[model samples]
Target chain A: MSNLLTYISVNDGKIKRSSLEVLSRCNEIAEKNGKTSSAIVISDDCSTIVENLKSYGPSVIYTIEDPIFKNHLNTPLLKALTLAMSEINPDVMAFASTEGSKDILGALAANRNAAALADVSEFDWTGDAVTAKRPVMASKIISSVETKGSPVILTVRSGSYDTVEKSGESKVQSIPFTFDKNELKLTLKEIISATGDKVDLSEAETVIAAGRGVKDEEGRKLIDELAAVLNAGIGASRALTESGDYDPSLQIGQTGKVVSPQLYIAVGISGAIQHVAGMANSKVIVAINKDPDAPIFEIADYGLVGDLYKILPPFIDELKKIKG
Target chain B: MKFYVCIKQVPDVNAPLQIKEGELIQDANRNILNAYDASAVEEALVLKEAHGGEIEVVLIGPDKASETIRKALAMGADSGSHILTEGSEEFDSFSYAKILAEFFKDKEYQYIFCGKQSQDTDSGLTGSMLAEFLDLPYATNAVGLQLEGENLIVKRQGDTGQEMIELPAPSLVTCSNDMNDPRIPSLKGIMQSKRKPVNTIAVSDLKNGLTNGSIKTSVVGYEEKPKREPGKKYEGEPDEIAKEVAQLLDSAENVI
Candidate 1:
């Protein structure tokens, strides 16, 4: 029996980086436990995805290519995954902490009467049980937890685990598509991107965040230009969103979405403590604020103390040249 | 129609965290209901206002959680059920869902609701897990919800965009922040909430006895994140700084 199993999620015919992270984490857990790791991908066509997944190094890769999965609804995918897991019966199962993944993982755990941890930022297998750590109280306190029972389910927080290179080959196994479609109680009518087909802030590699310093619509337009050049998701601090310059949906603070991207550039932001709590885990932080005493500079990898209006145009131009 | 909403009390996000004796201490300031749960309560109220229905808010927490439930009651929830428990720090999503399912299996409700996620654990697992435990279809991160005939249509925020999905009646949904503006309780509503029936159930009354050992998950303690040291700071011409920033992001960071 495989000791570790990871559910690899694919969107728009591509595997998300966070899914690979969960796979990498499973490999780590498997190695520590001296057992083999397995992976499962539910997609319409997983040939390319399975091929790409090899770099993460699982002992076996199982693909259930069913037309029913095209809808992106949870029940069909859950049924497929639950069935596969019932047969594999791995000691541990890991899922990426996305909306879809969380929905299915929770139910799957209940179905199997297994212990489940959600959005675990830190996890370790202690030979007898699995231990996990997650942030609580608005990321102020890190809560440590331990789980009991075989086949413990875990939802790994996105961007928390580092993705590593695979050391060996993995065997590909295509599982047969078998599910009663009539049992699906949910229907996916449509999926429309909110940002005009732009990447979501949580999944973006680069994020351009605005604060109160970007006072008006003109300033916001400049921020958008830079975001477009970088292909970055646009984020706003509570101050900007509250002032009606941006939507509350774009707010990033203690009360809003927490994002950990490869690069987070704070434009004209003072870096309130609440704002920093959300993106402090980012791999790199760049702060631009006229106020030299802005708290954002304290955690910034690169700090520029100057008027963002004068700085951003040149910054955008430089980025354009670099991209070209 | 009938609706069930899940509520949780969490530490105020605005309050400063204090570390005492190598352990995290709760802020003495007023504890507030989870923001998402407040949104969930508001969503349930909106539905109740449109269609004649009963709304009941459920919570599994310490005695103090009843205060959170009362807050929901003031917000127009008709009744409340508080499952009193101690040493619940280790109760994970699976165990928590099972308890709610056991409570709900006997009852017939048209819809179930919960916050997209709690600000405390931020796991966002309870609603979906409870639906699974109850053998019902569900959606998460829902910003918009409408009941059309026997089916429920919902708009959920996805990784890339918004998704429109329909689930059969007796389904579950989790409310995101922008679902609706939560209404402040009026003086009359607050007074009415005091008289609202808040049924309290002991943890042992549920299927699984409430204890850290009986639960599938257990907590150790909270640890603080390591502080980030200040990095390189540059102050000068925008053009020069921009060029240097681009070069460093490209060559050194490789994130450009």
Candidate 2:
């Protein structure tokens, strides 16, 4: 029996794609270590979610049903997870690098006195310990880290792996968890999604981002038209958003949203390291700029060095043809 | 009320990285305050202004770490503390959080703020780990913060959406982007920082929870990312370039 536990969180009664990726990765690691992989799903109800997780091939599913979980509050959830970790004592615990998982893993690392790695993209089990790799310095460098002890926690970056095909009928066990009223100090008031733009930049498959090179409102409309033609999400560089011309929520840079879309089209951007940090992991990058020396071209799989004004119209036409 | 903000000095990410001895070392001349921590300092200053509290910025790095705290003070923080670790050695997030928890154990503070993660390490572990070690409630990725009487409300950005949460005092918050635009140091504020004193403490002076060989993780090596091969460069008439790009996208790139 392998002691590998994956933390699964349900939002609005649905399993997050990132969480499923974590479970799938956990199964891979457990299989490599010749151990059984288990999962802990926290939600108001687990009957449906448990069915979904069993397809991922977990050996056992631990279900915790509590109304407080619906709010995504951290304190009570941390309390229950800590108690659950003690019961399992898994050699390795993997969590998705989602906001909730990061918070919980950070707290759980301290609560359980376990070493933790955040946003780890690669990992393997060795003779006595686990070694993982994570990007540093805006992914310009990768660091190899080795954990010496068991019960090491890792937050897996999204898109690092695929969720496995559903298989195996896993046994289910309901974990009894109680939250003390005094201990539950935080209250989740609401969940407000960014409006107007329906495509969440972080989750979009294809993204067309505008930079300061777009120049003005008129220029931005062309970029927007291109995005609409391609049916891709619109993103902005830090400079464009800071100029007060675009919404800050659309900004994609080191300090802004980190997106790993399948295709990222950067227009009029110089390819600063800060901006690249957010989108460097894209499957393919295309940069269109007037300056031939723009750094974005260095990493782009395809480079179109010319005036976007001259290039965008024809580019839009080509995209429309493809769509049609 | 007393508020503590933790800041770090990171290499300006825009500068080209320099590799030495199988590790990526940032250019010393281009170091600046970490982006996320700058947001944390701004959040602390905003909350201090609204709640009538004293703001103290803290750092746990080399003696040069005081430079980051000075930047925070120039941004309107009241004071600074530098926990100078020996040489350039760095600790993992868990050990670093333990040190912060220990340093603040004897101090009086209602709220502690930190960046969601450092730009160099990109590990969003310290804030919540510090909260756990200090036995306090915590929140991460706070984009909006509001104070109501003795209670606190924080709006955090999640993968799917944003969550607004309410918490009492004695909590820790890790700030993210969209929290607020960090104010550049004013000339007057810079002059005041010159006179402000920064208390420096050696790491050995404090009771850290980590013992010899207690750290469970270490960076064994580093590798520079391979540069991408320069792809086809098309420079021609707008229509011709567009057609070539379209054909490439369809046949070569397969993105279309």
Candidate 3:
């Protein structure tokens, strides 16, 4: 009964999609165990975020405002997180499987000696513990993890669940927290944030990436035009960037920027391992390559084989017509 | 300065893979150490050659993966350690990190290197996870690294280009192939590797919930891409290519 409370992070009452997914899954657990769920968002800038959190059907939303907790990541956030976890005393503490948030969660989970799952997409609450489906051994295999602990720490992947719908507001409360600053170990001086890029590939709705198959500067012109038409961001394979045909920011692959867009257009890229590592998470992958056997086709939802010399122009034309 | 290069063998990027009977199937192609990790090894060797000391390669995987170990040793690492495990394939990041964390609990190595991500999983989660587990500083995708007193003056490749970050000694770094061409195994080095140390470890030694339940995300299933019709090639006709391209772009692809 006391173990049903769940603490979640929210923004502007607008909870991050992954958080909603975690809450959605956690809600299922609460129902099964006859427990209650309460989510939390710690931020001083929380304007309408509390309203958004209310829509998700949390029994309570811990709204704590502090300049230190304003930023979503880094700054040894575990201090604030640990405080929230301890105060809420939830049966499970959850976070999104993200670079920054997960790092904080990792520390908290270790401190609490709770079972931690990385990048779990599915969840099930059996009698004793929870089971989740996670990619293991470098994404070559899928493994099932069974976790047991009062506060099971879970990090759900982004885009794993449907949008959080309004289940009506049950309760919302502003919880107070002032974590120690000296203990904050990881000091992120700067995020190396991207500016002047106009669009970020990771958050873009549409991405048009070029590969080595781009015949010449001609290919570049076509991609730019397509991006402009679709209002999509421009991305590139290492080959094009390595050849100095495009900016490194346009590069997508291993050691490159990871992107997950609604429409991912990979033009002239062979989809090497390094390149695939970046864009493999895209929802709809469309490949345009000259070689029919190019590896890009392996994960692509739609693949077009032919000389970029022949295919790209037609494809761009088709897109233009659709917009017109 | 003695260097430590952590190398991993992974499936070929272009290898065709499928899931059958709850297992993965892939083409039988010659396995190679990851390009990025290979670059790390090469960078280490250059350090070894420049400032003489042993460069040992460490591999933590199943026995079959020792081939990569031999390859790293052959490629120029002075010696190797293949911590062979019977069922390490089932190990999670925590499990894998625990093994390294427990094994190197007291061992001191000035520099530790790994690839940004393994080609097979491309998770790129381990080294950073290891750094967290070992309580060490970590820098990913370094283009170049130089030792400066008790710290490493390194230029790591970020999401964009090279970034300089200075971290104290005994830090973990993953090299991306942004700079320095990787080296192929030489005949002399390959021959000499036969006499180098290649130790193995039992999988059960570092046991403590080698199993993971950390929720991140999982691949629901393997999907095969559909076939496509090939497009025509453009010769030296720029005007004609542009016009035809423009028409096709307008009709099917949609850019200009």
Deviation (Å) of A120 in candidate 2 = 1.0
Model 3, B118-227: lDDT tens digits are 76654455666666677766676666777666567666544323445666667787777765788878898788878878888765665543444433233344433223
How accurate locally is residue B186 in candidate 3, as Cα lDDT from 0 to 100?
86
Which candidate ranks first by DockQ, i.e. highest?
A: 2
- On lDDT, the stronger of 1 and 3 is 1
- In the range B8-121, model 2's lDDT, one tens digit per residue, is 888886787777898677678788899899998898888888779899998998877677888888999998889889886668887888888889988987889999988888
Order of models, best DockQ first: 2, 1, 3
Per-residue lDDT over B168-209 for candidate 1, one digit per residue giving the tens place of the 0 to 100 score: 878999888767779999999999999999999876688552
The true-structure Cα RMSD of candidate 3 reads 5.7
TM-score of 3: 0.74
- From the highest lDDT down, the ranking of the candidates is 1, 2, 3
Candidate 3 lDDT tens digits, A128-193: 576777644334355555665556677676555654554856666666766565645333333333
User: Which candidate's TM-score is highest?
Assistant: 2
Write the number of the candidate with greater TM-score, choosing between 2 and 3: 2
lDDT of 3 at B115: 79
